[model samples]
Target: MIRGEVIEAAMYEAMHQAAVHLPPDVEARLRMALAEESEPLAREHLRVSLENAALAAAGRGLVCGDTGFPLFFVRAGSRTAVDGGFGAIRTAAAAATARATRDSFLRPTMVDPLTRGNPGTNLGPGMPKVELQFAGDGDGLDIVAVPKGGGSEIFGTFYRMLYPADGEKGIKRFVIDCIRDGCYAGKICPPAIVGVGIGGSSDLCMKLAKEAALLRQLGEPHPRADVAHLEQELLLAARSLGLGPMGSRGVNAVMALHIELAMTHTAALPVAVNAQCLVGRRWCAAIDAGGRIACTGTLPPRETEAHA
Candidate 1:
């Protein structure tokens, strides 16, 4: 059985790490963009982004001032048992968010929608959203934390009930149109990681889109050849739109395009688009039956190197 305190401590560490470190894949993509960018302004922006990432890695401050919202995706083994039960995980997450706020690793982003009152601690209705799934029979738990900023979330789009005849062409059109119309102003941060989820119900489509945008490594292709090709095609098309870095019109319009698909009803097609800014922040960890934690995906450079 996993102790409640152990889960809480692991979650706290994950939250701080995610807030302060830029994922390796994201940093690499930004560096590659910097090398390819010709526009002086865009190049400068990329440079500043890298510098900020380096500073955050050193624990100087958070990668972004906004710090965004705390989101967790969890996979728990069927046999795994927590001392305080499943509710313990939620309690741990809430306490982690509060600590992150106190340490200034996270901003107080949660507020009462109606009153707009700040709760000081990042806890309230719908705050620290958690999505859970059960898998396998081993006594273990896996967790991923994604801190999504307001700008990107604001520009996300979902559409349902498109004719099956639209198919690939229709999906491509929806994605490109969303970016051109909603993201051209760099509201979601340019050279963004765009995720397209096709098929499934409305909610599932959006969830898949988010997972694609936030979980998958940059430039990694989907396993299916057809989906991979579609990702490349969309990436090319988005670049051709000239909505380059920060929407200032440059060569690199997108960091990557990831697509996730699921089988749906014969007549119904649902699609969703989700975006992640250049600063994509996520970290993951797994706790074994023995209560040992193994973590990955972007810690401080010094810490990572030392661990290596």
Candidate 2:
């Protein structure tokens, strides 16, 4: 059985990784855009971002200051046993959240919504969001930590429910408009990563949007051909908006676009949009049955995934 302490350690490391090291895929996307950005200011923004990433990775400091929200996605094997079962996952998450804040890897950003009371430890009810899943085959655990930025979540997330007749045109319109608005004055902090969710229930679409934005590998195309085509069209539209990093005039406003879909009610159509700032903070780690933990460059499998 894996001990709770080991889980906490793994979680803390994941948190630090999320903050200090932007994902390789995300960095690669920025570099790809950097190569094409001709506007001097826009190109400089990309250059600075690359330099910032290297500086943070080399132990100078974190990639971004606003540590936003602490989110943990965990997958467990059916054969794996923990010291405290499901409770251990949450407990370790909280412990890791507090530890990250204490160690200066995370900011104490969580608070009481109604009273606005600060815990100063970044631990409150549902502060460090945890999503859990189980698998039938593999023996151990995989966790992905995302230091989701507050700026993007606040300014770039949106939802709309339309009649089924709205169709793909409506979907495209909604997404393009959201991107135009979200990147206005560089509020969403381009070059942003955009995620779109369609055909799911309201909340499910929102969750899918959030996951698609933060979890997927940058520039990886969706497997479904139709959906992939939509992604490409919206991506080009987003870049054509004359918005660049910090509102510069260039094609560097959007780094990537991804969409996740689910079957929904026949009568209703739902869509959600989520975005991530240029920081694009995420990290993955795997813990073996013996409690040995190793960080992986590849992202963790989602709840929507199945074991092979």
Candidate 3:
């Protein structure tokens, strides 16, 4: 069976790694944006970002100050036997989040919504958000740890239901509006990765958008040709708006735009938008049935990477 310690240790490492290291794909996009940007202020911001990434890589500090949500997306296999049962995953996540906060890899940002009480451990009721799924028959568990930032969640998220008649034009218009409003003055941190979810229930649409933004590799397109084309269209439109890194003036406004779709009610179309800040902090690990652990980011994209 996959031992609890193995899971805990892997989560511990994943948490810090995600916090401290900018994912290679994200860094590559940033470097490209920096190369293409012309505005002096925007270029400087991009340069500073890369420098900060280097320092963070060298153990100097976290990639970003707001480790907003220490989330664990666990994709487990039905055939695998987990030691201490599947509850061990949540236990490990809580423990890992606590330690990460204590060690400064994560700031204590989790709080009670009603009382605004600080837990100091980044763990609270429904906190350290864990999204679990049982899929595939392989004998292992794959965890994607994302320390989602507050800037993105608070300022860069959107949802609405549209008349099905609004069609593609309406969807495009809404997405552009979201980018314009959310990324203004870098409130949501410009040059962000945008994810759009269409046709799902309200909550599922939001979750889909979030997962697409956080878990996707930079610039990866949807497999469906129509969806991919729409992504490209929205991306180009965003660039034409003259938004640059951190809301400055240039062509490097969006790092990437991804879309996910699902079948919905015949009369209504629901849409959601979520963005990941330029930091794009996420790390992955897997544990075998025997409890052997391996940390990696090169795994194939999730089967649910795109629904349409």
Candidate 4:
């Protein structure tokens, strides 16, 4: 069985990694854009971004001052067992967030909504949102830590109960309009990654859009052809708007666009657009039933074996 202590340590390490490191796929896209950018100012922006990434990877400082919200996505195997069960998982997350804040890897960003009281540990009611799912071979656990910043969250939009008549054209129009009106102000950060969700309840649609924006690797196309086409079209349309890096006028306005879809009721249509800043922060780890751990993007090595 996987020990609760091990899980906690892994999560702590993941939090640190998420704060300090940029994923390889995202870094690669930035580098490619940097190389191709002709405008001197835009190129300079890309250069600074790359330098910041390098410095953060070297453990010198954070990639961004605002470490944003801590979000965790977990996929647990059916047969996998945790020593302390589900509560143990949440306890681990809270502990990890607290530790990250103390170590200066993350800022204490959580506060009481009504009283505006600072928790100072990044933990409070409904903070560090966790979503759990069952997938894979049912013998392991997969966890991804996503640090979503406030700027991008501000640009997130949801439209519910649209007529079916709106169809594909309406969906595309809504997405492009959001980028132009809401994101192009340089508030959400650009050459941003955009995720579009369709055909679910409002909350579910937003959740799917968030996942697509933060989790989907750069340059990876959606599996479905129709969805893939929409992504490509949206990417082109967004670029054509001339909202370059930080909304400067340039050729590259968006790094990637992804769409996730689900079945909805016959008459109602729900859609959401979620955006991620240029500095995408995410790290993932997997632990097998045997307690073997594998992780990427700055997560530290597991220090102990699982209990038998």
Candidate 5:
């Protein structure tokens, strides 16, 4: 049986690296948006975003305090036996998070929604949420951690399609409709990432959308070609609406659109849209049997380097 301490160190480093390593694609999208954006307000937002990214990296601190509810995606190897039992993974992750909260950088965003008080730590008996999937036979682990905040989450919405033919049209409408709805209601922070979950049961659809955000690489292309095409179509339609950064008005609003799907009952096509704000804080760390970290990366780079 493999020990947990070695795994814990690697996981902690991974979470740190994930916070530091913003992937290239997401960075490119933001840089391009900054260049193309014209309106004073929208452009200003872009500038702040760039600076914030730089600051997070330089300080090695979290970009935003909304450290988000930690979501864990664990792919455990079949041949590897966990030290204590079936649940050693959770304990390892929580241990990693405690170190992440104290050492590197991440804010304590948890609170009592009713009392309006800070919880002081990111740990709950089952906090730092996690989802596990077991596959393969090697003694390795791949973990994806995402910190989802409240402002963007407040805009989350799901709609049950009344008819089958309405699926595509309904999706388009729901996205545009949700943004519009947010505009009218005046909350969803703009320049958001939209995750669309299609054709899954209600619960599955929601999970698919949130998981879609963790996929992270921009324009990575969905494995199912049709869904990939739909993502492009949605991007065009969404930008054309003039929602711009913070909905103040510009050429581009959404940085990217991510879509995921599941085969569903023919009678129903349930869809859910999960919105992620500009302050995206997610990282990934891979570990092996020796408890050594393999790789670490983040969704956006903390800074922009000028070309020579």
Candidate 6:
């Protein structure tokens, strides 16, 4: 068996790269919008958005002030073992974040909520929320790192309907309602990419919705016809909101509205909407039995351009 330390070091490098590439996804999505957007204002907004990403990349800093509470989703193979445990992985991550913060001049957003004093480190109890999945593969692991900012997360919402029999329209309406409520405060950071999770328990629903944002290539729909139809229809309605990038009031405010649904108890119809800002910073890397792993950026590559 390969030593776990090798696996840990590789994962750390991947996570660090994930943070560095934060602006790539943002730039891609904005460029895609610019191509498809009809409004001059929306196009201009996308241009500025792209420019911000470029600046971040060139300057090597977080594109936004809120680096967000970090999250790690790990898939570990059966034969592989974690020698230092997850705490070690998290410590390494905080060190990477500290380095990124200093290099980027990002404000230290992690402070003790009680003493009103700053611990000065981004490492909170669960700040780097780690989710581990044990896959029955050889000795390796896969890690997905996401730095979720609050600006977009405030738009995340949950609801419980009378029952699941409320069906598709009900689910659609519930999602639209979430977007409406979230944006009512104009803080969701528009031209938003919305993720909806239906039928899971409230907490699970929220988790699924955020996970949905990381599903970059699995686009448009599930293989099921009815599910695909609902995805397309809801997407159209969401874009119709005219909330355009940053809720500036223009067309194509939404890039996509993604949904994941599951059956629940007879009396439950739980739903959640997880919204994302224009700069979606997410990356996924896979480690196999040989302690080898690689990360593609989190979220889909911009539909318009690919980074060299």
User: Which candidate comes out best when scored by TM-score?
Assistant: 3
Per-residue lDDT of candidate 3, residues 56-113 (tens digit): 8898987888888889998887698888888988998898889889999999998888
In the range 1-308, model 6's lDDT, one tens digit per residue, is 43445545554555555555553555566677788777776677777767666666675454666777666776655677665664555665556556545554334566667876766656666655667666554466666666667878855555555465676668878887777666653467666667877776777777767766555533446455776687788778877776666666665556666776665677787777788766666667665556566667643222221210
RMSD, every candidate, angstroms: 5.1, 1.7, 1.6, 4.8, 6.2, 5.2
Per-candidate Cα lDDT values, in order, are 0.81, 0.88, 0.87, 0.78, 0.68, 0.63
TM-score of each: 0.93, 0.95, 0.96, 0.93, 0.86, 0.83
Candidate 2 residue spans exceeding 4 A from truth: 301-308
Native-to-model Cα distance after best TM-score fit, residue 264 in candidate 1, in Å: 1.7
For model 1 the TM-score comes to 0.93
Candidate 1, residues 16-112, lDDT tens digits: the string is 8888888888888899999988888889878988898899899787888877888887778679998878999898888888888888888998888
Clashing pairs in 5: 21-298, 22-300, 53-302, 54-302
Compared with the true structure, what per-residue lDDT tens digits does model 2 show for residues 193-283? Answer: 9999997789999988988898788877887899899999889988888888866889978899999988899998899999999988989
TM-score of 4: 0.93
lDDT of 4 by residue, 172-274 (tens): 8888888876556567777788888897877888887887787777757787787898899899898788667777767566799988877888997788888
TM-score of 2: 0.95
Worst 10 residues of 2 by lDDT: 299-308
Candidate 2, residue 173: how far the Cα is off, in Å: 0.4
Ranking the candidates on lDDT from highest down gives: 2, 3, 1, 4, 5, 6
lDDT of 5 at 86: 52
Model 5 per-residue lDDT tens digits across residues 89-146: 7888788877787763556666666786766667775677768766666677777776
Better of 2 and 3 by lDDT: 2
lDDT of 6: 0.63
| Best-fitting candidate, scored by lDDT | 2
